[model samples]
Target: MTTSYPAQFLAVAGTRPEVIKLAPVLMAFAERSAEAKAALGVTGQHRNLIDAALNLFGLTPAFDLNLMRPGQSPAEFMGRALVDLTTILQHHQPRPAALIVQGDTTTATAAAWTGFLSRLPVAHVEAGLRTRDRRQPFPEEINRRTIGLLADWHFAPTPRARDHLLAEGVASERVLVVGNTVVDALRWLQQRLTEADLPASARRVLDAGYRLVLVTAHRREAFGTPLRNVLLALRDLVMSFENVRILFPVHPNPAVQEATREHLAGVEQIQCVEPLNYRQFIAAMSRADLIVTDSGGVQEEASSLGVPTLVTRDQTERPEGVEVGLVRLVGTERRRIVAEAAALLGDSTRQTRPDRPLNLYGDGQAGRRIVAALLGDANPPPPFVPSIIPTNSSDECRYESTQDRCGFQWSGPRHSRH
Candidate 1:
């Protein structure tokens, strides 16, 4: 039996979070490169931040559409990306058999919509995530739900997300509750870092008794005032603590740059450096004392690493960490953020603690589960928690292991007669 199509699949990711989560899926697809071709497309919605995550993951986008270079308003970026995506969907010689997209970002929404209109079936990873309160998370809550309307296969991270789609009238057969692939990513990075050993320069930086805080923030909602508040609080934290270094990876958005510099400049202890690659970012995460960000992915990553995270946003789509006491929400409140951060300066949850269980997401094999479901595999699958991927609500946190990963398995191959 021969597999056909462009011999590769296309994955569309625009932000750092999307790139981070999608890496596992892309790697899974890459694992099958002997039989399939996988190409990545960037909408440039995330630009610099995305590039860092991609480099860390050691993945590359086949096409880069500089959608956000000049810095467009939400309306402008969305409209432009949509038009660009439609063009990509219309062209691309020997089109991919499936398009892989993760989570809800402007880029994912546009790509999915374009794929749908092109009559190209989409396999949406991290599908069916919802906040219920649309305006609270703004376009994200809507972006994901909207993409679900047209997606052919939903690779949900939990039963809750799957149920969300079912409630919205998506067919049960089309929704598969695959655990999140992030744990796999985290585990992979953890192993790689442990094995390779850090370089002298980076290791020296880590060894200097400097407590590192990994910080990231880039959201349309947090553009002006909210951005300033968070940045100021971070700057204050650096000034207040000794040997406390803040590794703030600056996002490429002009607004983010201007706001970060305006608030973070002259703060000697804070290193607002260029975005590091995915592997490099993970190294930073691994080396961090505490993680601070407005990113949903960071919440999940920090949780898996057992690091305490202060989410700068008002709400989050991944609340699993908060449920387990691994993540806290400080929003963009300056004084509140500074106070909370100061408290965590000397303490952090140790990943080596024997008591922590890894369940809120799944064992690292989510990618496997997705492939299995697509091929109609039946295994003793873990029952997915039907709660939303918590960004800040504290609840139940069940941890699992990579050894426990049976996240995906295939019953049989589907061979089409060409």
Candidate 2:
């Protein structure tokens, strides 16, 4: 089936990270225009800014599973997403030969499971990224592990991730260390950018030779007091660095907005921009002198561009960047966050930029490797697979054994459409 539709791919993403990392892979399919259709299905988990990102890539979702409620729990979100995406899966004409997803989100988790049930081969991009300590990343750690088990092809981003999978027992032949696709997306965004594409407010802010210090903090741990501390640090930085322009793409969550506004409002140097489009975002990050973010994707992005990152969280899954000197885990430590950003800013002038440009992920070719491996040409790598009910029981789920997992018998359409 992979060979039969070499260019066809159904790249599913709903969260910002999934959308960002999967953008390049999705673009790969779209670039093949005549040979493929890279259909996008948004489970509406993080639809807040994804459309702008998709527009940046010049792509739109074929199906939008607007499966988000104002206040939804992980349990509620995943359950709703699964139920909704199932119907879309049933209706998608010329259903994809492969369903691709990146990282771990309820959308990815639910979609991968639905695809697995529908008997479509699921390829997990950036597969097997683990913090070892599952509790640190909330549901994501579990989601990736679950997807690792459900995914027919695991496209791991690093040897470390691949090794983690092998140590726990995934078949070596099914895993492929295809590096991270975030850089490919970043590169794509860079290539696709035009000054005209930028929002007027963002472009005006960018033109003034202001050292851009991007601040994005939205981790579960940093909700109450921790959020205030990070905000305080930003407040101090903006006042201290006169030419420093802070473009905070605040999280859509209301609490985040209120908390950030409490400390960061009415500051002249601080230009709090809306969550940028993906292409403009890449352009912004590439030009940024220093980044203060708690996002796992930003860690990888900062690493890829060699932009020094000050992580506002206490921990991260992609510490490969920190280990390699591209990022510093400042961990919401107010003074440290301020100081690190200050230090990086002090060192990086227009001329002598401290370069840490290493492709820790890969050579920006993960999608091709993913498609190549899915076609059954060569063995891929391995990722962490938990000791669940033995897979030897083919009696329970024949879909796992067959190529057609997507054609489930849904006599009536119950799930809603977007």
Q: Which ten residues in a row have the lowest lDDT in candidate 2?
A: 394-403
User: Lowest lDDT 10-mer window, candidate 1?
Assistant: 409-418
How do all models score by TM-score?
Answer: 0.80, 0.81
Write one digit per residue (lDDT tens) for candidate 2, span 1-418: 1212233567778887777777777766655566556767687787687777667666677667777788788899888888776776676666678888878888889989989999988888888788776766777888899999899888877766776677678899877777778767766565667766555555666687777787787776678998899989898998888888788887888779888778888877777766776666776776677788888888877766767788886677775666545678887778888888887788733233324334565556776566556554456433211111112232221111112422122222222110
Compared with the true structure, what per-residue lDDT tens digits does model 1 show for residues 29-127?
A: 666566566778898886656776777778767778888656466678888887877777666767778777888888888888888888888989898
Q: Which stretches of candidate 1 lie over 4 Å from their true place?
A: 1-5, 32-37, 49-62, 66-68, 91-95, 194-205, 346-357, 378-418
